[model samples]
Target chain A: MSFKAAVLVFPGSNCDRDCKVAVERSTGGHVDMVWHQDTALPSGLDLIVVPGGFSYGDYLRCGAMASLSPVMAEVVKAAERGVNVIGICNGFQILCESGLLPGALMRNNTLKYICKPIELKVENHNTAFTQGFTPGKSVWMTQGNADGNFVADADTLNAIEGNGQVVFRYVENPNGSANDIAGLMNERGNVLGMMPHPDRAFEAELGSDDGAILFRSLMERVAA
Target chain B: MKAKVHVFLKPGVLDVQGKAVEGALNGLSTVQGWANVSHVRVGKVLEFDVAATTAEEAKAQVKDMCDKLLANTVIESYTIEVA
Candidate 1:
């Protein structure tokens, strides 16, 4: 089985091409670039990606406007059926805005646009996304803005932990999330929403290649 | 009919974004430290103008809308009242 993925693109989504390149490289050129205006996702796709960049120019809030785009309607349907979905950076914001993922990613505590490579801890190793890595190791994190810390109620937080939904955690609490949460998975474990850009660290030249393991894991699951 | 929906992050929810905003405002002197802004809570008040003839009907439909979309009970809690 070939690994099929679609990278969603929006008006201000600067990282679309880069994300498409990374996914294509990872999946051996089996990735499709889908526009945000499209009404439906290609059928029987194995994975869908909402990539990074200041979509809608961060107008009302990051991902707030893009959440209402016609394409998200398709994404929500794809996710509900257990099709693997990944949201990175502003994509994470859009997922939250679209209610595919729980809680909201608010502005950073420092109120400054943060762009750098930080450390990440592989918190959950059971999902289709993070199982390729060692259960507890620090990886590299790249890209984010002021509104990046993830917040949810105690019950929702408990549910996430109880269900093994916390996928990745910031080792140093880079965005000040309550539990240093950098990424999460839905209850079904099919939908992954993360603030860091794994695409940025997928290549050896960028610094660390820890992020490649994520794509490798997804591929392994697809091939199985 | 006019309806008001008061939305708030649920109790026991950590408002990290709001806490940081409070701190920043304190630093900028918009509020005194630990006094004027001991804690900052953020929420939205959604006002709706409905065409329902009766207040009860508007309230019921508005409540459904609140439950279906406007509020996320997992992270956000909301109250709906008709005017």
Candidate 2:
């Protein structure tokens, strides 16, 4: 089965192209680059990838301005319709700011930008974004961001933890995020928001090809 | 009406920026009382004009804006002032 995915492109979304390439290479799917102001997403999208970057110049806060872009309205609608959605790095921040997912991505506790390959343990492999990997498998990916610390209220933390909403945890904490969360999925399991840069890890030359598993998993779901 | 909105991170959420600033202030031993500064939280102010005839109306409108966009209510609290 042929899968189709849309990659939303905000003003400062530098990683949009990388995400497109990754999806096309990993999933063998057609990828469309959607502008933030387009006001609509392509119909029948099997997946929506909100790629990493400092959208809107990281104005106000990372992803805050981009979250309000017209296209996000359509993205929210698609998510509600049960289409698979993945937000990476600044994209994750945008998802949280848009209220599609719980919590926020605050500044790193170290107050410095961190760019390095890191290991993440797949905490919940049942979701469409992680089903390609075995349960509790450890994967390598690149993380490059300044405001990647994930935060939430105590009640929300408890609820997400108890519900198995956390999909990935850092092997070694990098940004002081609550519960060392690197990736999280919504309760419905159709949407995922992660701080790491999976697009950057598309090949072993880039450090790891483990990120392909996510796109591959989505493709399998679409084919199924 | 002219409105000013102040956004601040809630208490309990670690303010790394504020802590860094406090550390710098404390390092300035050349200035008296700089060392005594504590809990030096940092926040942001946004000023804009709205089409409201009364201050109450402007305040309410700006407060709504704060709740919607100017602040992330999950981690930040906002105060609105209108003139």
Candidate 3:
């Protein structure tokens, strides 16, 4: 079975092409690059990727304006219909702003734009995105953001932890995220939002290939 | 009427930018002999004109905007003033 994917591209989204290339390389499938103003996504998509970068020039907030884009309304609907959604970097901020995922991405504790390769531990392997990794396995990927710190209220944080919604945790707590969380999934597990740029790590020449497992895992599920 | 909206990070939210500004101020105080400052927090203000006739109507409309967009509410609070 062939997997179909779409990568949403906002005006300032710099990672859309990389995400498209990564998806195509991992699944050997063509990826449609959808613009933010487009009213709808392609039909029968197995996956929707909200790629990284400073959307709308990071005005007001990193992803606040982008979350209100026309395409995001459809993305929210697709997520509700159980289509797998992966939000990376600024995409993670968009997910939170869209209310598809809990918590907010706050400015980094150090007040810096952190750009580095970081280690992430797979906290849950039951979801489509993490099935390729063993529980507690560490994967290396590039993460860069000024507002990658994940913040949620205490009760919400507790609930997320209890419900196994955490998909990844920073091995070294790079941005001072609450509970060291690097990635999260919605309650239904089909929607995921993460800070790391897995698309940037899909090839060995890019420094590591650990990120391919996430795409491969989704492809495996779609084929099954 | 014109409205001004003040948005602030809620207490206990760990304002990193505010902290950095406070640290810089403290360093300036020691070096340049300025007065000591404490509990320095940063917030944003947005001013815009609304078509509402009465001050109450303008405040209500601006409050709605704050609730819907200007503030996250989960981590930030906002105040609206109309004149």
Residue-wise C-alpha lDDT for candidate 2, range A1-224, written one tens digit per residue: 58899999998889999999999999889999999999878889999999998899998888888888899999999999999999999999999999999999999999999999999999988888888987766899999999999999889999999999999999999999999999998999999999888898878888899999889998897788
Q: What DockQ does each listed candidate score?
A: 0.28, 0.87, 0.73
Question: What C-alpha RMSD separates each model from the true structure?
Answer: 3.6, 1.1, 1.1
Each candidate structure's count of clashing pairs:
5, 0, 0
Cα error of candidate 3 at position A145, Å? 0.6
* Candidates 1 and 3, the one with greater lDDT: 3
lDDT score at residue A152, model 2, on the 0-100 scale: 93
DockQ of 1: 0.28
TM-score of each: 0.80, 0.98, 0.97
Off by over 4 Å in 3: none
lDDT per residue as tens, model 1, A48-149? 989998998987467877988999999999999889999998999889888888888876766578889988888888889987888657788586567788
Write the residue-wise lDDT of candidate 3 on A1-224 in tens digits.
58899999999999999999999998898799999999989999999999999999998887988998999999999999999999999999999999999999999997889999999899998989989886656899999999999999999999999999999999999788999999999999999999998999999999988888899999998888
Q: Report fnat in order of the candidates.
A: 0.31, 0.81, 0.44
